[model samples]
Target chain A: MDHSGISVLFEGTNFERLLGGLWVTVKIAAVALIVGLILGIILGVLRTFKNRPLRVLLRLYLEFFRIVPTVVLLFLFYYILPRQLNFNLPGDQLATLVFALWVAAEMSDIVRGALISVPQHQRESGKAIGLNRYQLYRYVLIPQAISLEIPATINLATRVIKTTSLLMLISVMDVINIGQQIIEANNHTHPTGVFWVYGLIFLFYFLIDYPLSWWAKRLEKKRLERANG
Target chain B: MKKKSFTRIIAAVSVFAALLLVLTGCGNAKKSSSQSNNPSSVQQIKKNGTIRIAVFGDLPPYGWVNKDGKRVGYDVTLAHQVAKDLGVKVKFVQVNANNRVDALNSNKVDLVLANFTVTPERKQVIDFAKPYMKVSVGVVSPKNKAITKASQLKGKNLIVTKGTTAENYFTSKQPNVNLLKFDSKTQQFNALKNGRGVALADDNSYLYAWSKDNPSYTVGIKSIGPKSYISPAVKKGNKSLLNWTNKEINKLTKQRFFVKDYNTQLKPYFGKEVKPSDIVLPVK
Candidate 1:
């Protein structure tokens, strides 16, 4: 209703500040997703090992992270970790670490589900061709598992992007935090600013997440097509 | 079949657009109707038999929600007194520092008593009552890394609550300092305790109270920047309410109401080191 209030986002350094905040969010998400992917693959593969104690321990690790909320984990890592361990870490670094652990847990579950979903005959067929254990996994099982993992991983990446908004709570100058600052600074002059300020935040998040969602959908469709063909 | 599906999609989109327009139109209509009424005038508030005052719900000693879920703090008590003096029922709207002014401007509340510091920039948009309390920016840090002077803050990390005078002051005057701004008092203190910054700058009362509770930290710099007064703000051009509130503040000041407020609400938290006389504005 108040175009003037919304116009402030376009004026002066406000838009630039918002973009800087967005960059911070993107950087955090990107780092977390990459690190989590690597760690998750290891954990997922380890869980599939024949060692019973190791599998049980990995299961506990996954369940612990999956059960606790991200915000709680953030607080635990940011607040409790430093005092308990006598080591200081920046809030953004702590947030990324916590998010990565969370992603690792979720990704492990996705990988494990995909690995188990592969047909037993497929692995046997790879071995029938005289492929070694590692070669069988590389040439046969992993390729098939990757097709199953791609869409879910993209969906998880979107979740990481959405979760970066919580970084504002711990004083990380992410996009949502900067949006709050802009609204706080101008709200006195613009009474109707809450609507437009928050609306812009919604738009920024959608612009980022919507494409990821679309890509996930496209990947899923392609997987379906390949399966049919 | 393809044409029929295309027609269905078009019809669905049009219906969704119409629904969105109707919803937004209803919201605009309600806002306009409330604006037209303008029930913030003193006489109108009296006629309506109720006054809504916005105060911070998280900033302890100033305004906070008690464990019992009732609003109990210095500003809340003062707001209740104001309503009682006007023979009107009081409704307390909880607001954070960022949204307090907007709460008044948007007519969501008739008055804001959320430890709002009076400044020229804010004066352009909202009208402040006569000063009720005065406070200066103070700095707190770990005793081992105490910073007594402004010069020490150079290249040092300082934590400040966003939208506060401390943030604005350091941003303009001490641009070289790394200022970490948080949204609430709790987060600012958490950042300080978590070793996010070397010093935390905020209102003297808040820093004083916090340092008193946490022995590891001390108030290194007692004052920074010019003294600012905390006053209740009304929407700009609300002459009737502005005049009435100013008169009420003056009357209450003479009664030493703030002295009682300081003793009851703040003394327990800030300790005996913080004097009531030093912070409460003199009656004028």
Candidate 2:
């Protein structure tokens, strides 16, 4: 058993630090997802309106976030926001502010797609029942659109989880950051630790993400069965 | 149907992987962090009784967290001295080559002790106390294909951490040598180990420690360019903290504290190869 480099994890408190790192990742991801869900839902609903200026404004917002890479946005907020705001935001909070905004833009697009796909007859039926725009979304559009939105929304959860990795570059001490610290600490005797350490990180990400993906697949399967039946 | 699902999965995975093609300008920390003139940082630091010093968490023998999850290294030793001089506790904020300047300028830390090499451009944005260490750029390569001389790097990709003196030197002086820049020491060394480049360029001091750890490699190019110095830097013109740091450095230099720090924190890693006089600047 060539345990040479593998000891880096088992040695001292290194493994515990990696878990702390994961917890840090989870904290950031949780903030982003929860805030994103609220803001995204609101933005998504707003995007469905027929107002031209609002449409143009929302389209520009979506295009800007979509066209700009997420990592650049991460750096933008991590480094620039403090200067612009003249106050410090804790790293995760700052990241949440940027992420929630981006996710809301993405979510709005998703919401628009789902809402428009609810069939014109459904819209007509709602209008025939004297449902106003607010009532139509509250009573009719949102319920149906939800089923359509579930899988992609679940996919967003996984995306948000993976996105937390970029926080490593900004001194966030994410699992990847902790792993790099461990590797460098043991670089002398454990030169090969990178494989084991990164492999474990791969497992950590897979473990957290696989269940969400599995649930998404299951949701899609049930929808398919309902459609066929 | 199965193919559609696979492609959908691929698309979904990439949904966050980003449709990023050629990144446009986003954030340059050095440009904006100087906006705050945090003159009261010293007063706040003293009142709080804790001085925050930013350092590299993965660069060993300079600053790194040991297996105990404790921050330790040459830079850390200096940090302890700074905190002691101010009669305050130390809060270590880990920063990297890519973000060190911003860490200080943004007021995230009262001072930066991250083996920050003093440079002409950096002087424009941050205030350096006094230098305590001497450094020059060095290249390390796999023993099998060593890069002993600068000319040997003619067209080969050389790995360097972003914002380091090595990157500045190679890009400005050895332009023909393709530079593959990473954000941290760990990544550049990983790039070198993974064969991403022919060699890695860094402070020869760090290269010396790293090459000792990874036996298959050697600091083939021992030194490069002119000798530079490393110092504790604060926000641009934060005179209170800057002056306090200067007085502290002067006192430590007179007491030969860095030589003492060298014997305890650095000597074991450097062994017989580096003497206290070789790396210590005496901070006069």
Candidate 3:
């Protein structure tokens, strides 16, 4: 409500900083979604392998990431991974990498489910034509599996965007980080400006993730239409 | 049917590849953001006639939101003065402890006033102005089971805000103390109040402030370990700004402006327990 302190947010480099941070959030989400999809497909396919060891290992990987909290996983990246694994990455890059790995693990289960949902008759028909295993997957099974996974994939992508805000803990200057920066800078003079500022931040995130949600839903409807037609 | 499916597969892969390219381009664009040196180049600031400042908004008493939803605290007080002394219209920017250094280095802020502590490790990365507040490390405990000595903290759960001097000191010296560190003091205080830990360790001023609002909690001890000073921080190699700030501190110290500052900003939380002289360091 205090227009004076909160108004600074709209003017000069402060607003630019917020946009910069939003860009970081977008970058992290995009990178993580892509990496997650690729890794998830590999893991998902491995889960179907006849070898008991590989399937079991893939299942364990899927379970571990699913059970652990994303923030704790992020901590593992920020603190333990570098010291133990010697992966000395910058904070923002580390956040993107870790979130991608987490998303991939979660997404693997979605991929596995979608793959299983593809009818056995389809694979049988491909085999009747003497199609190679790789060609069968590339031509017949994977595309249908992905189309089924689209809705879940969009859900997972939004989750990555929401979770990227947690990277503020490790000092990654994302959108929430900019909000914190603005609040701190103005607190002394504005004293009551944080509510408006943080309130506006909620709006900023809503503006981004909500549209993605709508687009995903619209795409889901189109897929349903094509399936019916 | 087989040809149609193969075409679909190729299309999907190509679309996926295009998405990857666009995202990679986005990442590169962010990483290579234009290096705007306006704030860092203080020479330009002198010409512009304004200095930008960044402080924490959610940190109470030091920097936090008040009831009407505005940021207010001790750091904000000095920040306004520093800008005034610079003869530039002050532009306050919000930042937290985590983003303080980056905000400064990125030229988003001219100075950092976010309850920043003067630590040797941090001094290496950023130049610090003269210390304005005396910040001694202390602990808060439930009145029922108070801890009066630093040695009492050994082997007990000590909740501290992560990335603070409290965590640093305890981790370095009191290794046996089980640290349940949180990112915010609100959480640390909650842990202490909820009986999740025996005590919470942080700056004396914060403990004193907490004790005032909640009489049930008491600060069992005063200061422990090597004393720490709180000061505004600026980016390294800003000698012009640093020297100007040092002179301003000297003027404020001579004018008893610091006493006024302490009385206005800190006295409410401190009450009559801590003498003014105890807080006011000898001008050196």
Error of 3 at B107 (Å): 24
The parts of candidate 3 lying over 4 Å away from their true place are A1-8, B1-133, B136-280
lDDT of 1 by residue, A169-221 (tens): 55467888767666654543464776887888889999999999998999899
Report, to 2 decimal places, the DockQ of model 1: 0.02
lDDT of 3 by residue, A1-229 (tens): 3457667576446677777788998898898888878878866765665669767877887888889988788767665554343334556787877877788788879888988889999989999998866778878888988889888888888878888888876657788876775775565456566787778778888888898899889889998999999
DockQ of 3: 0.10
Model 1 Cα displacement at B176 (Å)? 54
Docking verdict class for candidate 1: incorrect
> lDDT score, residue A68, model 3?
90
lDDT of each: 0.80, 0.82, 0.75
Q: Looking at model 2 chain B, report the run of 10 residues with the lowest lDDT sum.
A: B19-28
Q: Give the interface RMSD of candidate 3.
A: 10.2
Model 3 lDDT at residue A147: 85
**Between prediction 1 and prediction 3, which has the larger DockQ?**
3
Q: Please compute DockQ, using alpha carbons, for every candidate against the native two-chain complex.
A: 0.02, 0.35, 0.10
User: Candidate 3, after superposition: displacement of residue A133 in Å?
Assistant: 0.8
For each candidate in turn, the TM-score is 0.49, 0.80, 0.54
